[model samples]
Target: MLLMMAEVLAFSRVSEALPNSTFWQFLSFHQSHVEWVGCSLHDLIQPSFSFLVGVALPFSLGSRLAKGATFGALLRHTMVRSLILILLGIFLRSMHSEQTYFTFEDTLSQIGLGYTFLFLLGFYSPRVQLIALVLILVGYWAAFALFPLPGAGFNYTLAGVTPDWQYNLQGFAAHWNKNTNFAWDFDRWFLNLFPRESTFTNNGGGYSTLSFIPTLGTMILGLFAGKTLKDNVAPNQKIKKFVITGVLLLIGGLVLHLTGVNPIVKRIWTPAWVLFSGGWCFLFLAFFYGVIDVANYKRWSFFLMVIGMNSIAAYVIADGLGAFIGNSLAIHLGQDYNLLFGLPYATLVKGALVLLIEWWILYWMYKNKIFIKI
Candidate 1:
């Protein structure tokens, strides 16, 4: 949630302000999404969020079941939550558009598209869940690998890729190239079914609705981790399991990419990316679990806990209210107020203020016991 807020607050502008500082530049690079074929800190944000959703499911399911909820009730709630998430994603994406943007590539919509399946899988044994994960990964990979690449006479420009586009992969890997692969073609048909300002073309960033498949795989991984944590096992065993699984996944993803069997493309949520990003997600969970839960280092995470608890609310505020808050600050404080920190730091100051206001909103929600869940 903080990372999402940072993106909205334009924290990367700090790097722009401090162009000469290598440290700031490095941080800024990670703050922004990578163009293609590589992972950045920002790239991991969506995967982490999606993965954590799966991680939380076991507890959520257990709590509701213990409260005497039936499968019918839980399934209904899951459907409703999925619908809300999908519509919410569209609404947020449409905030600046002419008509309702029907894109389903955003994080929420992508998760929503797969949440029902994830929920259904939660009822099964871990072995079944693992089987589902393998099927999803392999099936998705094969689908892409089998999709025919563009012919020589095909116009790259029509698909928004230039003839000499630097990121275009060659040979088999080209099957996952931006704007020209299976998901892109699928969206060409699927998204146009809804109302649009114009005919839907390729998503500029190559994100596709079909990515929800592998995203489900990511969630399944989280499900495994969540179950491990929730089970009556020693802390060290859980930590060990997470670490070993993380290492294996990381290596698996790298091997796939290195072998040119598949590429790790987050925009498309390629199967290899599921393994790669899932690896990082596991390691991250292990670290946090070790420090906060096992080691009892609770005090420092209070700030994060506030945001984490009200993540949906925080997400809404960050996406919906950031501009309003920034404008309000400028109205009250004067446009030049940010310049107090000098010209280069103007963006930094304004963004910092915006972040503080957003955090306070979450803090207020936390204190008042007003978490917005979906």
Candidate 2:
């Protein structure tokens, strides 16, 4: 429920489905991505999901390690899992027909990279992880700042094909990471530079080695958070620490933006964005953690847990089954309802219908204990 609300309602494909109506225009804010170079409530959905994965890492891996899991076991597990995720991301990036699918802009690939980094961070302590986080964020900032684009300073100088931040980098990525579940070669040899391959798309590029830097910060922050939750400290103490940390991150990010060291770009996952987004993640989860674990208010979290439990499944289902039924099927069924509402109210009602239908699918999965982990 919490996760799904974050994903489905987190975006506006549904709103796009009803452009002719004022109602949709009003609700459009909820369903769309941030305009560009700024933040919005909708923008946090993907990073928050990744951050949640980070929060779960300590509990899951620590449990196995406590039971005598070996270092090799952990590494092998992490590698295999990341490979599977890379494949899954490749799959999602290719989900639609060739006409609809492009080389980048898939969320699963981002999640795959995030999980892989989180796996490695699990081997380190919070203090050490914090140092690495700073290095990754600052290191990438400097790297891009020094690396020249064809026609620009420091930023990627992608060909004029698109006005995106990284034109050359994404195409540079597309040449090798084009999707065979593995691309055969850097056949364009001149384009290959970075170890990881990512394609450029108008929406955004996934698989960017550059984006990984701040995203790594997101994971470290999550690890720090996960460790804090394990402490047997008092509730007020926990709240105070998280609140202070969140405030500091928020304040620090704002101050840095003012200095212009970072501009808080979401598409590129800038350092400022990482700090800002992670701070919100900390603040948001702190409240939830305080209530559920600290105050023993487990019942209230149940609604969110419903959506959270089957989160990945819900994402897959939404990607797969959602359009057919809630869209075309509903249109067919609406021979009756459509007569009453027309396109205006009907479109709004359709969004509600789609959401309810998606929730029910989640409800069904929950009842059956059919949780799918990536």
CA RMSD, predictions in order:
1.1, 6.4
| TM of each candidate vs. truth | 0.98, 0.79
Global local distance difference test of model 2: 0.63
Model 2 scores a TM of 0.79
Q: What is the lDDT of residue 44 in candidate 2?
A: 78
Candidate 1 residue spans exceeding 4 A from truth: 8-11
Q: Write the per-residue lDDT of candidate 2 for residues 1-374, one digit (tens) a residue.
A: 24334343422544566667666565567555554445776677767876777888889887989999998888888878776765665666566645333232345656565666678878877777888888888776665555433344512233213434332233222221111101111112312432333543222222343454467678778778888777788878888888889889888777766666665656667677888888888899889878887789898667667778977777777666655755574567855563355544554455556667777878888999888875
Model 1 lDDT tens row, 78-180: 9999999999999999999988999998889999999999999999999999999999999999888888889889777768887578988988899999998
**Against the true structure, whose TM-score is highest?**
1
